[model samples]
Target: QEVVKRTPGEAEFHQAVREVIDSLGPVLVKYPEFGEAKIIRRICEPERQLIFRVAWQDDKGEVHINRGLRVQFNSALGPYKGGLRFHPSVYLGIIKFLGFEQIFKNALTGLPMGGAKGGSDFDPKGKSDNEVMRFCQSFMTELWRIIGEHTDVPAGDIGVGGREIGYLFGQYKRLTNKFEAGVITGKGLNYGGAQVRTEATGYGCVYFVNEMLASRKEGFKGKKVVISGSGNVAIYTHEKVTQLGGKVMAMSDSNGVIYDKHGINLDTVKLLKEVQRRRLKDYREYHRSAQYTPNGNIWDIPCDVAFPSATENEITGKDAKKLVKNGCIAVGEGANM
Candidate 1:
């Protein structure tokens, strides 16, 4: 209640805080010092937040402006390390929610990193390559003043991927006059990017689910899986799951969902999404027998394993109920979108 009162109108951020606080009830009781120090209150507030205007020209040479922000939420552990999301839905509350979660998530890793998140409300979809590059240039023009190799490192999230990262990194290099590869990640392999970085999240999700299954004396062999989003995470998850003997029947995007009862072909998916940057509808062009439902719920399909690699809050109560009714035994958040 106090947190919500302090941060009014940020319902999502308040909810995130409440969820963590509720889980920490036992911990607070055990360690009264946390309450004494008012650590929770401090954690709720950001260390620094920079909000700037990102103005760029479109393909028609028409100038437009959008809000850009970066939130450095915590640094008690180490330097801030997180991803920069670019999407039409990004806002301060959403960024704060993600950053606040990142703090504890980083702490759990025992890594040399704290927590931060940055992004813009600009939609990269349907934009020309030149327009995207120009937008990235404008975005980094201001962001470069705050980030560094040993200070804050940013990667990709949601709309920000290899293409976006390359543009941002190129602009950073041009502005800073140095090739600091460590300042950003998700770079192309021609540079210093890790080969597994693209596959890590998808593969990591499968591994986590595998561990859970292993604990119960089960595995991915012959399990029916449905993964949302045909992006890097979903495609790689499909690949890895298929390799592990799981049958992936469905994948989706913001537009719609595609259900292939015969299972997805990884090579075709990769060529369509990764190489051509086409939508999930294009998947049907190759697999004419598969079904594509526009703006449909992927969860409605029956499955044993469900991996959501799409947006936040995509699986609502009704969706969960559908998944439960369909006998879904395991669900993994394979990507943050």
Candidate 2:
């Protein structure tokens, strides 16, 4: 309550803190030393928050400016590590919320990386390749000064992906005159990108769900699954689920969901999305029988497993009810919240 009152206008951040605190009553009771040290209060405050102006030109040569931020929330574990999301909804509140959560998530991973997040309210959708390149270069011009592999490594998230990473890394290399591959994680394969990194998130999610199911003596083989989002995580999740013999019935994007009862054609989807950078509606172009539903109920579609691989808060109470009603037994979140 005090945090919410103090940080007015950061509704998301406030909610995140409240949820975390509510779940930690047992921890505080067991570890009085942590409570006495005011660890929660200290973690609420960020060590450094950088906000700057990012100006870039579209193909029309018109200049536009947006705000960029990097909230280094905590470095208790190690160097600040997180992703850079490019979306119109990004702001201080969202960044703070993500950074705060990353602190605990990193600790759980048993990795040396700490917690931080940076982003801008720059929508990449409908932008031309050249325009996106210009934006990434301009964004990285200022970002390169503060980021290093050993200091803070930023990767892709949301609207940012391989193309954006390539542009950002190229700009960073031009400015620093060094081929430091460690400065970023999601680079092109020819440029020191990690092996299987493209599908790691989705694969990790599938592996996690498999473990959960195995504990109950079940598996994805022959199970029906529906995944939201057509991005890297969602596409790869679909691929892995199909490989595991599960039928992926549908996938979605901001525009809408793509339903294919006969199972999604992963090859066409990958070509359309990853290579062509087209929208979900284009999926029907290749598969004549595939259905494209704009603003339809993705959860209403029946499935044994559901992967919310899209943005945050996409699945509402109504969607949850529909999923439960339709007998969705498992759900894996590929998106970081």
Candidate 3:
């Protein structure tokens, strides 16, 4: 395990990695076979971590330089697999957490994949489509050399979606001149994307919850569910819950949450998220009766089931207590914790 501390600023991330490694030492010693196989020690560190400078010109013709990283953690089972996140909050600590979690999650899937994660701290919220494409192209220009179909495969995460992936894949293909289908996942359907890939995560959560309910002799029929976050996961989770006969009472984002006690209109929620790409605050304008609580807590609202499909740590122990007190029977987590 090679531990390279880039600078004093990366202390937090380094400390986190050290803590995780320390915790795993006991487990490694307990499983003598794993120690003999060197699996635990081998899994404690990333195989490779590439940090590069990305320079791109903004629409205003101003040159901006951003740091990018691709952490190919391990490939013990198969090729490295994870998502590429692009957000202002991205950093070494966040990426490392996601990458470490991916290692175990991929193993649980019974898939032949190891673990990796990459991204930058570039916010795409207000940027034009052209600007986003340009940035992605520039980012991929450097990233392509380090990744391939059998090397490390990256998919979509917080800020990287279809548009970003399209720009990235185009750049990769242009540079390598290789039409590799398996090099990336979460691609457009017309271009070798698997069916139900888009809705897989969100829908899978709903399906698991349904099974849990069935096991307990209960189902989603007429149940009131509260979903936080209006992104792809939240939107699709809302859709699936509705399909299962549950009425989604609310959905939220960073701006706020909108509660429709009369039952959430799935079509309207879709319009706000999919078509408009707007915040949940705008939902109240269309439906006057829907209560829009700006910057308010979604867990405060009463519901039967709670799905915190937003970012990590959004639902803390405090929020969990509130949900349990509010009669929340089941809680679903979508993001990497």
Q: Candidate 3 — number of clashing residue pairs?
A: 0
Per-residue CA lDDT of candidate 3, range 1-337, in tens?
A: 2443433465444555676677787787778788788675566567888888888888998888888989898898899999999988888777877787788889899989999999999887877788888899999999999888899999998878788888899898999999888888888988877888888889989999998888889999988999888777887898899899999999888778899978878788788766666777788778889999889999999888888898877887898899999899998887655
* Residues 1-337, model 2: lDDT tens digits: 7788778999779878988999999999999999899998999998899998999999998999999989888888888998899999999999999889988988899999989999999999889999999999989998988899888889888888999999999999999999999989899889999889889999999989988888879999989999988898998899889888899999988888889878998998899888888888899988989999998768889999999998776688899889989998888898765
TM-score of each model, paired residue for residue: 0.97, 0.97, 0.91
Single out the weakest 10-residue window by summed lDDT for candidate 2. Answer: 310-319
What lDDT would candidate 1 get against the real structure?
0.89
Sorted on lDDT, best first, the list reads: 2, 1, 3
Give the runs in model 1 whose Cα sits over 4 Å from its true position: none
Give the lDDT of residue 328 in candidate 3. Answer: 90
Look at candidate 3 and give me any clashing residue pairs. none
